[model samples]
Target: MGQRLSGGSQLLITAFVHFQSSFIFIFQDYLEENSTSIYHDTVSIGGGSVFPQIQPQSRPRTESLDLNPESSLIVEISGAVSDKDRVLFTIHTKTTLPEFKHTECTVKRMHEEFIWLHNYLVEHDQYAGYIVPPVPPKPDFDASRAKLQRLGESEGSMPKEDLQKMKAELEAFRSLFLQTPKIWADSSEYLATFKKTVAMHEVFLQRLAAHPALRHDHNFRVFLEYEDELSVRTKTRKEKAADFFKSVSKTADEALRLTNQRDEDQFFREEKCLLTSYHAAVKDATAAADLANLQRKTMAENLLRVNLVLDNLVPKERLCTSEADLVSVLSSFFEGYQKIQVRLASDEDLKFSDTLRYYASDAGAAKDLLYRRSRALADYEAANRALDKARAKMKDIQAAEDAQFAANDRFKTISECARLELEDFKVRRIKYFQKNLVDFAELQVKHAKAHIDLVKSTLDRLRDIQPASSSSVMKEPTDSVGVPATERTVSLDDAFGSAVPFL
Candidate 1:
């Protein structure tokens, strides 16, 4: 009778495990399909923007999207050093191109220099059709320094282990930020700033390098290969004011065009609407990801505090043997859990949040391309009207005709370039989001498995110390479905569901 009952129980557990696995698989499929469906539905609504939707069966192309694949120019931020109030970046360049003075060279540049390069690209009339990469943000470490200061102020009441951990982090920061080691100071802030800025600058240079026309730009070549400073000056107050008003005028023009003008081309019309919605969605996702990361960091800190308390309790000589063992195990568990949480948070920030933020900015650039095209269209129409009036008046007819012809050429050129840029933007966005999302999902699964293992091991240790009841010995930890936690496995497919398509 006992044997039969045990066999029956085993069968029931096996069936339950299968059911649970099926449920998870079904849920994952639902999420993948539902997300895609929602995006398509949202994009299908009437708007000026147009984007080609990725078919369910179609795979994103994996070929090099670079227009100038043969270009041998390489640029990198090799290192950076902080002066009293300024940070200077060492831009290392290597090229086999004849345009450069040398095959390899390095030059120091500041944040303002990077801005100068971006502004030059933006204002140049010849490159107006191209989607200029967004400017890299200025590196700021104020928040990091403030956090370190707060940590220092609380040092008197903090546990020794926590204090030591913070010091170790600071040391790591110092090593990353400076060529020479310095005393422990605002390491987290500086390290974060360095990583963010380097990533942004690298993306900016890579974008410029990949462009067929921009790569050959004389100013860009000088920026990369020139050994001396570019000697770009900061904008004067008058210039700044002019720039502000120019931006305001442009915004007003965009709004007016959005209301009055409708794109005749179906492709461009969908692209404009699609890009605007996509950018807003990406921006929201980035914010949510950042908030989640912040919460995880806070949780890790709390876990550290709990671990410290347990560490202190474990050393108490008055505690019983079982109590001491339990305390020690708890401390070890929390410490490991805290470390895993920190690592998980960092992975998500780097792979998910940062990727979303970057694409958000890039999407904005794409939108700007649409805006510029629209503006060119408006100019062409205005020129046509002016020509019509001149023909009616029979005065300055030759000049009016020339103006109309010029506007027509400019509009056609911008339209063609904008189409190519938008297509490339689509391909690049998909490639990046696919890679980053898959990596993030895999990391999440790996961390989750680690968490389960930690809990299972901790429970086993605790069970061994606990006094046995008359009923039975402690059994191995099992998940909700009654499957052993140690036996549970998550495959990449199960975790990632399917390839996510981006707008």
Candidate 2:
């Protein structure tokens, strides 16, 4: 506690003041307590304002009314620091003495030194002894609860036989795990080779699929061959699996890949073949369409020739017909060329997906399909034949119509020729038989005129004689008059073979 003596000085304005040697706590409790709270307020002594009241302390230590020579003053002090260690300092408040404040003095202001110096509860010589840092505890490893659980109930004790048996089992398991290294190595090598083979198979299938000819073949034949080869391979599980209680470690997808290897490959191959054939078929059909048009043009030309010949008076004939001759007449595209082409395509007998099917089943199916195709082709050929016959019949009808036209033309020509001849005969008859001979000559002219009529009638009769067959082929030959060449001359036989007495 800081010592102070308060007394009234009555004799003179000057009074004796004594500084106390007690331990002075240097920090202002009011300043320190309010150091963090209210700041110190300085007011002029002449101004007559008490420092805004610091919270009242427990009791007043001393009181004095000093109206001395210098000033009137009241000092209040509180602190926890021991004053013996610091030179006592004071701030002059209630006066115009700002220079008296401790903070007003600036020396070397080492920022933390002053506050920390104030924190000592006692002098450094009074501090007891050296402080030691606390040590952290060591961690336990073997004693871990997890290790105890791993040891199981056997941690405390176990029967020897059971112990022996477990030891033996562990030894046996370790041996078993190690025993097949050679076999495993061989299998590993085999698997490596198998992987390469599989890679080749995949590449081949990919190439086959990419082939322009094989895209749509649903069976994928080239891929199927790889599958067939895979099926023939060793499929037995590894011997190591028997020793292991662990269920086969292979996943379902791996097992399936191994198992269906051959089957998948087989399907791909068959489909490829079918796709190739279909590509070829499409190419063929286009060319066939063009050929068909050209044939129709030829047939039109031949028919036009027959039309022009009959326009004149010359008789149209099917001379020297033969049933077996090669006429070089073109086929209608569908019947002649296309039918042959479709047959060629059929003969390829390409087995696509169905080739992978059961042999008897595939054969039976093929046979049935073949039968249908053959029957259809046959029916088409028969229709083609019927069409050919109808076309030939048309020609015969046309020829007959042509012959009638020819006959009409001949009749007109013959009548015109006869009329002109008779006109000439009349002139001659009148001149040669001067009335006497005219009658005989006129009768001769009538006879000759009658013969001409008979010749025309014979020709008209021949034109009306329809042939038994209208085929382009016939062994018999006919002349331009449509009479058989070897036929007895109709005019000679009917008109002049014998002349009887006139009726």
Candidate 3:
């Protein structure tokens, strides 16, 4: 780290840096060039996009995962100052639910780190362009250590009480980490700013790797000086270049594969096919129900006419037998027709038709999933390749150099695992859709058959019934009950329509 300075001293440094910048036209031009380069690098490296990597397939969720701030886990701390002005806090983690998992770890506040980061951001306003996340005031470590000494733990060894206290502090830190979203719940500006800072940093790294002038710049060196770990184990330009090249190659390959996968995806088209089939089925079912209802109404009307003819017009006539039989058959057919309508109304297939339409939208989502999965796979491959190149480069270098790229290998491993998990999810999703499609087809067949049976039975009943005697049915009745003179026979063209579409 650089020399720690008071607020006034840091202001003086910023002023001086600003003045130096004003005198350098060449550096100003370089900054402009670097800004444009940043956009290109952020979007793509070696003709392949890298950032905003694809994620794995998320499980279908019926409810949101957002946590209520008031209901979330929280860490509460109460502090008291010692004679040395050291703040010691008694901390504990509390959750809304008893079932919430808990683990404790060592907790050390980032008092010094906060100061350094704050001062750096304030001084380099053009570079940071964002505020640091809120950090708690520094606690007095000296006072805390003194209290620990008084607890009878000698030679830097910790007593059980001290260890327990440390555990509580660790738990507090962990709780705080988990509660970040809640802590910054009011505004997302912080996150946007954070992204900007990261992008800025990434741009700077790429510039440093590409341009020697930037590597030697006083301001650049000062900006990098805080990264003490990097200084401890450094890689040569050649090794860095090798890693970058390997990453670019992997990213390009992954992007290509993703594009191919997207183009080859049949889910969207299949979903459309399914929707069209379902739409046609719904129409057919609706038409069947309409026809049945019409037949029932028509039969009821005919029964009324027959009743009028038998009760008053032909009460003691032989035509009574034929009229009574007609009434019986019509009533039976109407009852059966009503049942068919009822079944059609409550049909699971009809209900499932809506569900099919609902899930038809999933095909679109599935396409998106494939896209995301492809991107994620590419990211994982790129990370893995970069790590591999780093490791290979380290093999020929000192152990210190190996330490510089050790984290790369870990990151790459995690990415690779994530990609594989996403791939597994896709496979599972495919199976799920396959089963759903089969079930839908079977149900559709069953429903179509029900409609066919209803129509067939109805036609058979109509054919079996005939006017008892043509002259008896046609002759006018003179009784008080008046029957309509219009013919009661159903027209095949009007009722059944040409061929029973489905039948």
Candidate 4:
């Protein structure tokens, strides 16, 4: 692995050097071009273009460390209340910072409010160098609700026991839907949506709190410390259209910038390539994980159907006593098995699959940071060219110099901050994966143990059952008809192996 990484690094360096040399020659040719033509064709400093001009801030002498020994901001989604189509999250903020109105406070925020905050951060020029956390997706329970409706429509055909057990499980889920109104309390769909949205929101807030600079943002403070509704409204059609076009322009600019520019910083160059590969790999992993979870749910549903069939069969008056007894045992076994399968699927989705999905978004955010820096670099180069043109033409020399200096300062600041942010990202990403993977493994072990116990108890119950007649009782099968006695016996290792083959 070390050798491979070293070789990749060498290739990257070689390519960068080659590109740099090629750019120098191309730039010399452009410089040699008639200054009059260049001056006439070049856009004015304030002219609208693909790359927006950024106003420079006073450059900091030293990069601020993402650490606070004296005080730390802690934020959490304490509870959530669900309205008809909206959820109000109770954001609890605790800190010792004097900047806040109170050291501790709680505020209610809706999903739209979260969107407002995320957009505020993204649009703010001050945060251009930072990897702003991705906006939490709007909570949508339409699919879950549709599934519930289907389940209700089919309830009559489903066995009474299975229906009751499923309802009971949903009710248990409702208990986790903290402070939800009675109207939405009984809804499995609402419960799931509430839990998922709350988790995403919590992660967003936690990330902001942990960031040294973002935690101090005035808008973030208001979001956490203010008690009333933020009164944020949805964007109008015109605004949405504008944003759409802006995003399209940005996409185009990113591709152009990447093609034309070679990152002078080796660290950023390697990070750019690493992030691209990581994002692709994570995306593929997420799809596979989702597919596996879907298959598990389907398996559970099929098991439930079989359990229902066995249950219906056991009650038939025509069936013999021994046959009914056998059907009853099988039905009971399947009931337990299906529940275990359902729980296992949910666990995997929450712990493993969601983690991968979240990191993929995070990786994208990191890549965006790189793109911003690249855009800054492009701007700096453009400013330098304009300055040279101004000097050659002896026109607006002071204005051109100011623009060049501002661009240079902005580029340096962004590059410095970006390096620190990416390093922190690497550490945080590793820690997050380790913790979640460990928790997932532990949960798998717990579920597998439960599964084995269920099988063992079912087997014991089957052995205790007596035949109703001689015809119903069969002698032990010979080696030719079935597995020999030694082969039939399963050790603990075999049980575990059978229960969780992936593990």
Candidate 5:
């Protein structure tokens, strides 16, 4: 395998390759015109003269001419200052280019400063609800030094072209806020104010750095490092929450399965059995009613034959009196039977089995609600466990490394917040289930009232058809078979025989 270059060297080589690619595009037209020659010595690949020098375009200076305090704010990063241990950057700002003095800074200090500027701008941008001009990234002093070392070059004796490129990049970085058209379009009024504020903040930071007492303070020196730890905690919290939701989603699916199973096992089974029993009772009742009607029609015909015989054979006055009495009894018996038979037929035809369906619905709803609550409780418990774990781990970390105490405190706060949210969810779920239970109870009461009213109506119908003892007493038929039409009188007790319990 071939030896690989370091990341720094690779970055420099990549930039070089990109520049060469652009050069190829620009020179392709010239090469096409001279295709007759297979080889050419004047084809400069680096920076020689395959192409003629082009004059630089002049741009009108847009910087303010007045030397006021706000307009005096300037910024630039000069080049690298390498040592045996680390590379330092030379920064220059706060005046016109000619008057600016260079200041040396380490990479770590510059990174912290850049982070401060970037974070402040981002926070303010969010508050204002618009984009702000962005700060340039910290200069890559170490990378530049490493690239130079790989090429057997020292910082003081770098390639002229590379030095020019670095200077150009720094110039662009300094002019980013003022020269970019996008910044002006985004928020014109805030641009100058933002620059002034950044300059003021930089001055304050410099003042703090100059103070002996505050220069070595942990709070001042470790802001960026602390922020990194906080960011890690935030990421971990989000991952835990995402995992919880994923697990709860699967629990919800399992709860749904349980709910459906309960419905099938309990209410659905009861409903099916109810329908089967009701239909069977109705069939048997209908058959009984048909038989009773047939018997009544036969009795009527027999009574009419007896009446005709009495009208022809007996003495006219006595026969007429006896015939009227017997006919009256027979008619009363037939009417009573018909009335009860009609009620039975109505009961069979109506088949009011809504109670069974209502119960099925109620049971299904209850099962679903119970299962949901069960799953929610499980999730709530899981959240509690997670919070406990976080708290325990935080305590361990806080004891293990004093530097992590602040991070542990933040994690503890996050865990407490999560716990509160879970408690609120549990409270809401309880309220919901309680309301459902109340509604279900009312539903049962309403069904019960309807059932009682049906029984009362049936009883009233039975009482209305009860025969009067003296007027419709039993009597023997004129035939010697000793049969009495009144003896066949149907009662409320007999009307419902073995066919009413399901109803």
Candidate 6:
């Protein structure tokens, strides 16, 4: 959490981020330029590769957040300080909805926590509780004896034991006790807390959005500091590297079991043998792959930290700044692009697997394998560009090498997969040319080299062979006519010249 000073403000501002996966698009004739209205949806938001939409999975959205008057759950809040205002909000918990399941503890938890809210609503029903969710839990605490017996073994155990055992256990627990948590959580139990809180917040946000007082008032804006998951992930990566490296010393590693394909001996020269299928599927890897998954699950404090930071800063940052003050105001915008880059980098890297498999099937095809690899190749180029950018931005942000990353435990099997596909395609293509289609095969073999040379010549825009060679990343331009190389130029007249002398 490094601090940077700006303007007259000496207050500390670490990296702040906001990512709105849930957005209500607004398009209005009255507004010349498109303006953002947080909760009020002029248009329902949907997501794909570019635009991420809101309502849930792949289809029609449940309810529109239209800013028009027809929208449900309108709320109005009035009188507050700037974005940094410390105004309290009351939320009633119990409500009857047909679709909602009557969960036990949540119902009771809601009743106890919002008793004051219920009281406040009774007196000032008009606006006090408008922000409360439409479908909230009924009062009940899920502490059944059978429930405790079944669900409480791993987490709910521990005899006070002896003093040393208690101290050691507590100490061990404290080591990695609280880290990156889920996105949404109250002081409730962990089972389904994150989803519940977000559901409740959605309704509240909608209601507060429509509130006449909030909509009209300039000062009482409901500034939302959306959590960008990047920071948590970034910190997670840093922590893993630190933890793994900090305690371990440089040790001579054991010999790795790699089939040395290049090592030729007096014994034999054979083509590489590839496995038909990988045994320990990447999803079941015991080491790096598993660790990565565990990291995703155990991320705890960072999540909480981001939410609290958001809660504090959303109101504060918006007070004197406009959204246009991107880098000038919020640091999230500065760091977020890196996250986006990393995501793209990761996807491109995975896509390399696809590219390898497809090309292995048939690299000659202009459309199928070659076209698909175009994206992969572009990703490689993009990765280079992104690396340069990141390195320029941050002092020492080294990008993981594509080749090395591809060789990681998760990706090693992809090689085997590609190899099998390549063998099959080669056999099928060669067999077709040799037996079934003699004329086609002969023509293909004859023209392949010439066609490849022509294509290369056209690409290079030179008649003669040039000194400058293309990157080996692309497949070597092949023979236009056939499967084999025929680089030596031969004249039929030379062989017959001796016989022709007598004639």
**Highest-scoring model, TM-score:** 4
Local distance difference test, per candidate? Answer: 0.70, 0.28, 0.37, 0.71, 0.36, 0.29
RMSD of each: 14.8, 72.8, 36.0, 23.5, 47.2, 35.7
Off by over 4 Å in 5: 1-54, 57-72, 78-91, 94-109, 124-127, 138-503
TM-score, one value per model? 0.71, 0.13, 0.24, 0.74, 0.18, 0.17
User: Residue-wise lDDT of candidate 6 within 1-503, one digit each (tens)?
Assistant: 12223312212321111111011011122122422322133343443232222321231122323223343323222111111111122222221322223211011112222233322332342322122223323322233223334334534354422222223223322222244233222122222222333333333344334444333322112122111111211236876687467425211111121222232322111222221121122213324433553343333223333333333344443433322122222234222322233322222222222223222322322112211222233344555666667667884454434533433422223233333444544554354334323333333333333333333333232212122111111122245675644344322233222211100
- Cα error, residue 77 of model 2, in Å, equals 99
Better of 3 and 6 by lDDT: 3
Across residues 23-112, which tens digit of lDDT does each residue of candidate 1 receive?
A: 335545665565334335334346634433433232222112332334587666666677756678877766787878898888888888
> Which has the higher TM-score value, candidate number 3 or candidate number 4?
4
Per-residue lDDT for 457 in model 3?
Answer: 58
Task: Identify the runs in model 4 with alpha carbons over 4 angstroms from their true place.
Answer: 1-71, 147-193, 316-320, 472-503
Better of 3 and 5 by TM-score: 3
Candidate 2 per-residue lDDT, tens place, 1-503, comes to 01111212110101100100010122223334544232134553565454333331332212211112233222211111112222111111232233233222212211122222212211121211111101111112222233334346683596544443334223322332245321112122122222222222222223223333322232332212222221222213763455243324323422453323332233223433443464355345434533553354344334433323222211133233211011111111112332222222221111111111212222222222222222333334445455556567775555455545554454344334333433433353234225323333333334334443443443333333332221121123455698754423222114234322211
By TM-score: ranked, best first:
4, 1, 3, 5, 6, 2
> How many residue-pair clashes does candidate 1 contain?
10
Please identify model 6 stretches exceeding 4 Å from their true place.
1-115, 125-135, 138-180, 184-190, 213-503
Q: Who wins the lDDT comparison?
A: 4
The residue-level lDDT of candidate 6 at 183 comes to: 25
Which 10-residue window in model 1 sums to the lowest lDDT? 55-64
Superposed on all Cα atoms, model 3 deviates from the true structure by an RMSD in Å of: 36.0
Cα displacement (angstroms), candidate 2, residue 387, comes to: 67
User: Candidate 5 at residue 301, lDDT?
Assistant: 43
